[model samples]
Target: MPSQTKRKKPYSHFRLRKFLFFTVPFTILALFLLRTSSSSSSTASVSSSYTTYQPPWFGDLQTAQFPWNRLAFSLTNPPPKTLKLAVFSRKWPTGPNPGGMERHAFTLYTALARRGHRVHVFTSSLDPFLKTDKIINLKIHPHGDAESGKWRYNKAWELYQEENQKQPFDVIHSESVALPYWKAREVPNLAVTWHGIALESLHSSIYQDLIRKPGEPRLQSFNASLYSAVLPKILDEIRFFNNYAHHIAISDSCGEMLRDVYQIPEKRVHVIFNGVDENGFTSDKKLRSLFRSKLGIQENSSAIVLGAAGRLVKDKGHPLLFEAFEKLIETHSNVHLVVAGSGPWEQRYKKLGDQVTVLGSLNPNELKGFYNGIDIFVNPTLRPQGLDLTLMEAMLSGKPVMASRYPSIKRSVVVNDEFGFMFAPNVEALTTVMEVAVAEGAERLAERGRKCKEYAAEMFTASKMALAYEKLFLCIKDERFCIYP
Candidate 1:
């Protein structure tokens, strides 16, 4: 009886051990599945909420009693008291083919000067024939050799100092890192607008890697130096950012990153979205017809013209666009693609024949005409950094966008899903969105464009952006002017 009791005890212990081995794993698997399901539900809810979400600033703009709204009106009506502004831009727009940053500097300072401010731009040398200082209150002080197209920051700084000695600048603005950290540290009233930051570049590197094809060359090599190099560079940048007095983020996501990830003080960081020339890019039906006719797309035909502009490089997601559009044209014969801008992919797009129109790099006026011609604007960017000025330009031109679902674009430009369609950074996702746009047809797209134009008019005009910056400059000059009202 004693031997049997001992045997029973050993048998019971063995059974207990077996139960735990199987039960523990089963329990873990159940919990993981539950968590995944919950996460998916949460994502769906967030997406549904986006359909009704209007940006808080848009609400303020709509309210007549809002102080910011009142301020916008006041700035344009009689204009604010004249300010002496110093702008440090590495390169100023010399002609119609300036890059985005140069275009931004030109648009902003020009708008500020038009409002009666005395503005001086310290930049690299321009072409001899290029006419500048055409605006009454604006002047350009070029500092480097025009032949090399090399911008000398030291020379520009010397020019700025010489001018500052004559008349102190009310506010100094630096486009990106044009003003070096050493020089920036000494300027108390300086604000630097960050078009792109190192941390964003790190994320972009990772994003690009995730979507890379099986046989594609990894230019970013994200996994190889993620901890070894990228992280250390980001840390160095976070430390270097402290040298500047104030930071201006061009997108909402960038602003959050400045305060949270970069650990910059909340008061020192400001978010002012990039704006477009509203008058130049507008919804003109006659112009639209004329441009489309030139493209050989008949108005009466069922054809839907989709346009994409900017440098046709890999980072612009042209590879994904090329693949998606190729697949799209196979199934849908009525859809046509018009590409502006040029790069390595120009020849590839031209290979698509009559269905694709490769316009190459266009001048500002021609770019405007291209915008009016398209029923939908597609921006398939893989690098998620600064807000593309093209997005704003397209919206202002009264065209709905089909852009990547990056946080910068989703939060800032397409806050409401009604404005445009967004897809993940992959060929399958892009192709799906393109198909949806085709199904919606041109007339339905026009309705979306109208809504997009209305929202863009209130939010993305040069006047609004200039007014916001003017207010910030005023506040920086005098703390008493910092009051919201």
Candidate 2:
């Protein structure tokens, strides 16, 4: 009986150990699942609140009180007072990105400086531009690293406050993408330029990868690849946008977004088109042939080359472009694709297995030659990103364009179909456009390209954009200076 009892005790102990092992794991997994489910539900509630808004009461500024015409001024002519300006940008012109908001800032600041204004730029740059650290001329101040953008903003505010005490500033302009909410009491006049709005970005990021609008939100997940729909940053923007009375919209579509989405009054939102480096992007016949040869295009073959350049992100529609090219090539064997610029999507693009040339990001000198080689330039973006400098670069180079029908792109640059083509954001829409672009006669395409070049030169120059901004600054600063040029 003692031997049997010992054997039974050993068997019972073994069974107890097995049960505990499974029970402990099961309990942990159940807790984890519960926490995740609860978090998801709470996040969904925040995201859903932003899907709609009341009209008019929500800042639908259809009629602008300050209607300054663009056609009136070709240059930013000073009106008696050569005002002191304080500009804040997270980026500068010297960086790898010679386009976008930074490029606009550089052009405007340079133009303002050339006109003899005491322009000081507060930005995040290690190797700040300008030879001398003079207060009279155009000067760039290097603050904190851009990685800690919030820190930079805080420091920028502190710097602006300190500077204002020494000498009063006429206007303070901030990059609207990440404007510090209010600080209105500290600033007498503040204007923020919008590149892309928050809500629109949040809507796209649900499916689009690495496409957060403002700064990245405090994420619920450990992986940056997977983001929760309940964006903490976006929820904050729902309130933050209303803090400013004056806003600078980079395009008409941008202005409309501010007025309708954020409910900023039309009078408060100033629409200004971005400019391209005209001299930097002119087409060269010799360089065109050289670039074509480099891409392995046969001299005799009637190959219709299609080109695209920019950050190859999800919102840029790289997958759609590659996939559409595959479909478009089934019958049109005389077609080829050449893309300049590299990003996360390069690995995927490498697998397309076609006559595609990936010219990683080009230098300023290389850009002119690159545009010269391509027959058509395409912008297959999914998001309504204000406007791409690449598209303007392409147009200015006398190359025809094919772009997504985003309102901002359409209103700002796609003035008419004569200059370029606009397709809905889908593989099918793109496939159709590419097929037609390939099928179009050379003479007709050249005619369209010529029109694009002429129009872009007239409407989208740095001088013109700067002039419009200068007028807005004057209008806001003094009532008498608001007189139309």
Candidate 3:
């Protein structure tokens, strides 16, 4: 009887272990499913428009695999002529997580499409929601899953050649110097925009400063070794920049660099400033009050809200701004700070206390609300290679800017005591700018904001930018593009 009991015990133990293993995994799976359900249901409340902004080109669902059905409209009619345009940007403007280059491509192409251009955007970015290619009147090609950049480049070049065989493109415009043409320089009428030149960007103090600090440029890390290694690459990039018959500089400073640093012929370089969507960006008294109320501010309160947005990094001069904001808040209790966007440096500067509100990342509509809620928009970027589009967005929202005194911004923005303020990118200079804003009082600030809106309306609307590009393309087509006398 004892021997029989022992055998039964071994079998019972094995059965218990099997039961426990299966139950534990099942429990975890149940919990995970429950959490996912809760999250999906919670996020379902926001409007479909807020979640996805589909461009007009993605109208036909059959040919196009739109990541989502989102729409934004502009008051413009299609052009008289149907020009086949091919835009080469690596990332498609599908979601909110767009980079500077992506935004430029998106805004420019959308404006162009509205003007009757047969546009096809070739990109190497995927839409997380929809895992397929998309094409309507305007085609979106995704080549992100390629083995390497070289492979993608080769494939894209060959594919474009094949595409052109069917229907030739009237224009070939690429982001910065990234022109991966099948025939290289033989791509008939080719043009490229300059986002930034690697050599010229090294001019910023963040890159040039000798003594190493906590937040400094990665370019200076390898020092001599790094520069020597990448010097040839930089020169090759310059060669590409010079390849295009026409070169578009997003700022005056960029144009100057092309002519001076790269020795690009003056005949090739053209400077065109960035533009903002006026209809999308606007300041409403009701929206301002609603946003302020969410921040726990009273309706009658006149606290001077200073807002800044960017991927928080050293080159952005956030450390300098944080230090200056700290000093300003100590003396003036009425001043507050609102930071938009997030990055590695966020935890480093969270000590700014209750006066600071970090909203993290925001969508286009939410961003408009944030712009309207703030009094002054500050961009303390130490190294602004291209024109910061935030400046245009803020001005569109009727907010005065207090930004770094970078060369491009200086040439681009109409910064005066009445329009806006500029400061050296440092603690002392920015602190002084805040002091001046405080001394100017509320009425003067309001008037300056009005001036900012007026200026932005005239010079920074997407419609104006599209019209410029339209004329530029026509000029390129017929050597009738240049308006300069």
Using lDDT as the measure, the top candidate is 1
Which digits, one per residue and each the tens of the lDDT, describe model 2 over residues 1-485? Answer: 45654346658888999999999999987985566455434422221212222122212122332112234474534646677888888766665655577777887788777777778787764553433334346877657646422237666767777887999999888876434775753565778887877655754554354333457674556344224443655556656776775787766655655765567766677767777767777767798889888888876667888999988877788878988998887787788888888898777777766677787897878888889988999988877767788888898899989998765666567756687799877788889989888889555777888888876776667776766677677766886655543
Q: Go through the candidates in order and give each one's C-alpha lDDT.
A: 0.81, 0.70, 0.70
Off by over 4 Å in 1: 1-73, 145-148, 217-229
What is the C-alpha lDDT profile of model 3 across 1-46, one tens digit per residue?
A: 4565434665898899999999998998798556634533332221
Name the runs in model 3 displaced over 4 angstroms: 1-80, 128-136, 144-151, 180-184, 205-222, 229-234, 480-485
Model 2 alpha-carbon drift over 4 Å, by segment? 1-69, 76-80, 125-136, 144-151, 177-179, 206-235, 298-301
The per-candidate count of clashes, in order, stands at: 0, 2, 4
Q: Residue 120, candidate 3: how far off, in angstroms?
A: 1.1
RMSD of each: 7.0, 12.9, 22.3
Estimate the TM-score for candidate 1.
Answer: 0.85
lDDT string, candidate 1, 257-332, tens digits: 7876799887888777778888889888788889989988887978999999999998898988999999999989
Candidate 3 residue 154 C-alpha distance from true site, Å:
1.5
Order of candidates by lDDT, top first? Answer: 1, 2, 3
- With candidate 3 superimposed using the best TM-score fit, by how many Å does residue 116's alpha carbon deviate from the native? 0.7
TM-score of each model, paired residue for residue: 0.85, 0.77, 0.78
